[model samples]
Target chain A: MAGTDHDKPLITGGPAIILVEPQLGENIGMVARAMANFGLSELRLINPRDGWPSEKARAAASKADHVIDGAVVFDTLEEAVADLNFIYATTARERDGFKPVRGPEEASRRLRTRNDAGERTGILFGRERFGLSNEEVAMADEIVTFPVNPAFASLNIAQAVLLMSYEWMKSGFGAEQTPFAGPDVMPASKEHLNGMIGHLESALDARGYFRPAAKKPKMLDNLRAVLTRPAFTLEEIKLLRGIISSLDYFSPKTPRGSGNPERKAKVDRDRHGKSGETVKDEER
Target chain B: MAGTDHDKPLITGGPAIILVEPQLGENIGMVARAMANFGLSELRLINPRDGWPSEKARAAASKADHVIDGAVVFDTLEEAVADLNFIYATTARERDGFKPVRGPEEASRRLRTRNDAGERTGILFGRERFGLSNEEVAMADEIVTFPVNPAFASLNIAQAVLLMSYEWMKSGFGAEQTPFAGPDVMPASKEHLNGMIGHLESALDARGYFRPAAKKPKMLDNLRAVLTRPAFTLEEIKLLRGIISSLDYFSPKTPRGSGNPERKAKVDRDRHGKSGETVKDEER
Candidate 1:
């Protein structure tokens, strides 16, 4: 976990997010949460309906207080875009006039290029109901519309923010930053897993866990499924083998009841604790 | 918007999401919202703390009611995942047992391949406080963990679902389904964009909007920046050319004050309505 902390971000500066007359405090807070998830920091509000610093907004922001706390409030859209070198307005409705509309991906790429050239960029999210006015859309450098379900193209403000934020982060930082286990720990080979499976099967068979002969193959497959699915490391294989050895050591040497049915049942109970069949078999 | 409807989807089939012992209704609703955004439909709840049919969960889901409506509830994790052919358990903590671990990307790829081959797949999200247990993880085919800020690796359940759901959609759909304009509507070439920029800059220049002469170059660059940033279609370029022609048509042949200043301000107000300065300047 030491080196892993390198990727975790308290906040990142990329593009400003300007919400134009957002309606709900909860949505505002949720937008902040989504931004934090993808390493975006700047949040600017253009005349929020509920006004600034709503307790509801702060509460809904979850752990993304950094974003909410640092939010910038603007009196109007013009003031919002005044400082930004580039601006994109998000709207679902089509404008009557000529506007170059792009999906989130293309918009994100454009943002990356402008940011790389040391320019401030921002995206505008319109009011919840009507979206950006035609005049507001005209003021922006570009329009970004989602390829969403037509019957249900209406996206929650937070959802829209999340999609764009995700695209921006993925484009900039490459989404495949997941950490991999080092070479010091090797994955157990198929041969080793098979050996353990065979050992466990033999022990179970000795105790008649497979039952009435006809179900043996299916039962064997289920056992194999349980064993094969896990990606066992060398240490894990050794640990499982040790568990199997312990079970094998306590196996009945002679007849089922003659030696000790009690110990056999105990091992069965341990192996198939959830099945509830071991307890029933003991009573029978 | 007619041809645009072709890409819209009401729902899409993908991997299921199984929540094991999830505590809050709000979290469940949020999970549904995230799932719906990525087109994942199946949802199975395992022993929710507040039980089933939680109104709080429904309210929190926002417009993702379809997901909540179709959610299947079960008594235990085993029952929840009984129908899934492939399962990945998500957790942050390191496991002591033998289990194959994969990043969300790899895990999503596996899900896509399995799904394409006509097999059911699902991902397990454990409780919020302590993630999936070693025993629970052992039941999975692979372990999936986000490369989070190790210091704050505790992603809320909804956030975790959003990440995995996003990866699943990206893996299967190629992340570039942005609707490019059809052959009838080609993308405007760089030459065309440059022409439009030059036309707009000249128009603004003639109107004395560049101001005081010293800021001419920066204003020209800003005009070009606004004109060139958007991905314009052929129709959009032609329409913008028409707009420029209209502006040129109404250009004052004589001095600024000699022409009707009132009419000039109206056009400027229509063009840069949000700026407020246009209206203010006319008043002065």
Candidate 2:
């Protein structure tokens, strides 16, 4: 999980995450890792508890070295956020009600829009125990709070960062495109499905799975309905056919092609010996 | 951050968080805390690496004691998820693409829908070092992955839990209502704004701020536009009038009432002696 892909571009540049008097180096490191996870790189520290060049922070960042290495420290919060045009103060406590309150999603959207418009924006996070003071909250353009369980609303510094960073990433990049695409196999063709169904019916007929002869067609219809409902892919149909073949004829106790030698030979050829072109030709 | 409100009902039940062979008691504790922050209380463990009842986990959970106390342990992933009607496997690495894949938002929405329908659902997370194996992922109904930076895709166990829990909370409850409401101050009345503007203009006139008599109206118009644009609150207008009064005539070096005694008295009374009713009467 700590591995970093140097070959891929290290996506940087988002709202600066300004930590105002963060207490622990480990927390700071974790914050950097969270920020990096969501493509944020700018980190500004306002009077860190332990002075700059913290080994604990470096170690905790896991491989988000760029975020830590590029971190800028300021003596005061004012200086830390001096260059940013828009600022959001993150707090759990209620303030004197001068500023507008926003939830994380709205705040992230605003930040992303402003960032896109070429305005620098930042989100201010407070100390570990007590959050941003009334005065600090007043400095920001607006207030942003997470919709946490009101009773247990206090999120750890890093958890807060992870949440906001996630929203920021989602707002900017969207959540539709996963990092990697899923399997591209097509759904089973009706013809392919019918072939599998016919083969399975023959196997079941040999085993007398359709109990009463009068109920055989109804039982076959039920089996087909169950099998067709899943919309099995070509690969799945092939696997199901293999399973049926193994159950009916592949057991060592029974010789492989003892029953219906010609059909068994055809199934065997399709299963193990047919090439992609031959399979397509047979499908045609 | 560690405080919990015992008086309030503890929010229990969401998608069960199934950790498969999770290592580190601290991570388990952090995961529990994250879950508590978002109101998810169900925690199911499938063979935790170190034995259960870990003090480290309890300490790490901050005040999310209920989550830790209610955690259930199972011998296998199948046993852990036996009762759940739907399951989502969280993975940072790519799989062979058998199951459908979803981003966190989509996954959370699906889980919320299922949970609301009275179906038991769970999210599966894997070991800290390596994520859910292909086999473990295959056991779930679908795969859920974070939309993270492709270069730094890996997220530590707790961070991953925090992200998904946040999404779950947002999906169910929405992110519109912040925990606390903002200030309820109304916009200043036009009469109130004009009074402050006129008072400041008189002060400027007394000090010859409008250099030429011919341009005084234009100067007054510019000043009015600048002051009116902010749409200051009633309190803000009152504060501004006080500032104008202080700057024009309240210096200790000069007598308080020497410039304009009647106006001085009105300003002083409004600044320090008026009650809410008195202010309303004046506005009327």
Candidate 3:
């Protein structure tokens, strides 16, 4: 059911969808459908087969043309993702590299949460014929893979994206929690989320998630959105902050400890330029 | 041939066999029969109708008596798994509970990995007629469900155990390395896995995947295993990383438009767990 505030956007910020050399129009259409299923609209096609906005794809989109109609076509992968702040790649197979990998739900959660903080997030999907080149992966901040039987882990592009988007929609759309009825049974207040953002920022800052100084402004805005996106009841927010404080302040001292270094700082700096920066210049 | 090197255990770990109040000794016999076909040997009984360790059961176990002879019996599931590290409950319906769940293959990987970590792992299969109770499911750390179409997700107790056990045997028993050459490629490495994990974490972190800190740690771990289970080749991992990075990192942002904080961060926490979780819980 549409909430009392039906006019509000389901997603907090922009997330571009990049399909690197997709093998089929059906898959593109399916991906579009999945995006639409989760309220995603913008799609970037990087050398897709069967052309852009094909009838086949439109048919697959069903009611998802809102995504298809606005899809941007690009000849190169770099051009497709030039302006995004954070990017995640989805794959059924594991990619060998020295980076972080997560599940689609995890990736979607991170993307939605970060974007709620006000940064742009994008999800990358690969072609059916083969997948993305190694160079393309180096450009991404993270990877998203489905938990499947490794022997049978092959998932259609749309399914992969849809699952991720579904996760995003669940949390990003402020739908992550059950509909919290206030004292009078009304929805919770929106301002509380601002406080949640502040808490998150404090935790992140303590962990040094922010860079030296340049990314501070953009990062703070994003942090605010990410925190404020959820309509948290006092109790829920309490629980949220409780876990954060626990992890941030009372973290277990394992031999391998965690410190949130500004991992995305390198990628965030490039957000300023009107055009995008390609970290892995070598094409696969 | 078994890997003679000391690097691997001769018998990694068999799938956890769960007998949810199985009714007949003959069924247990056949269950063991099925398990042997897939090289599975672990056995567990919840509450047998005819009583466990019956001569009838011993007869059914046949040559699989090693499995039946050593089968574990429990008056209550909590007692059965008190010493185990991870427990997965199976089901088929869309019930009220269950959160983060996986299909059989993913469950197998979780079981194998936990086994590798020197933890006791087990699978739970419900009774012949009624399956597991909801309260019983509350005991498990995770839930496993089949990928059959919703209308026909149901499987017999023995069948369900067989499928899950088969996957475990595949993983723990050297992954059928020779019988299925699988394109003549090696699996992904810890280093390669780290990159994909990092990438996924950042993307999801930005998107707010790890909200409500208490659930985030477990959620992220679930996400990690899903992606990491597959044995990825170096080139393949790089390729996948490239493809996903392109979609997630690439693409231009749409112009900002009217949006509301009310709709952002819609907290429907129930969605945190996969439907499969409930299905396993309810059906089993």
Highest DockQ scorer: 2
All candidates: TM-score of chain A: 0.69, 0.86, 0.57
lDDT of 2 by residue, B1-284 (tens): 33456577777788999899999999999999999999999999988999898899999998788899999999987678756656788987776645677888778887777677676778999999888876576556677888888788759889888888988888776453234332233345444555665565554443344545776655444444334433355665654443343333321222222354355445444433222222221210
CAPRI class of candidate 1: incorrect
Model 2, chain B only, scores a TM-score of 0.60
Error (Å) of candidate 1 at residue A269 is 29
Per-residue CA lDDT of model 2 for A1-284, tens digit only, reads 43456688988998999999999999999999999988999999999998887999999998789999999999988888888899999987767877889988889999999998999999999999787888888899999888788777759899889889988888886535677666664677888778777765655444334556777677667666645655677766554443333333321222222344355445444443223222221110
Q: Per-residue alpha-carbon lDDT of model 3 for A113-232, expressed as tens digits? A: 556555656778777655665556545656665544332223446545655555565554443333432222111233333344444554444434455457665545433322322223
**Top TM-score prediction, candidate number:** 2
Off by over 4 Å in 3: A1-14, A173-284, B1-284
Prediction 2 global C-alpha lDDT: 0.72
Better of 2 and 3 by lDDT: 2
Put down candidate 1 lDDT per residue, B1-284, tens digits, no spaces.
Answer: 11124356666688989998899999999888778766787889988999899999999776778899999998866567655656787877665433456777667786777677666678999887776765566556567876654423336788788778777766666663333332222334444444555555444544544445776654444333223323344345554544343333233444222344454454454443221211111100
Instruction: Evaluate every candidate with DockQ and list the scores.
Output: 0.04, 0.15, 0.02
Query: Model 3 - which docking category?
Result: incorrect
Query: What's the lDDT for residue A98 in model 3?
Result: 40
List the candidate 2 regions with Cα displacement exceeding 4 Å.
Answer: A1-3, A250-284, B1-6, B174-284
Rank the candidate models, highest DockQ first.
2, 1, 3
TM-score per candidate: 0.63, 0.74, 0.35
Ranking according to TM-score, highest score first: 2, 1, 3
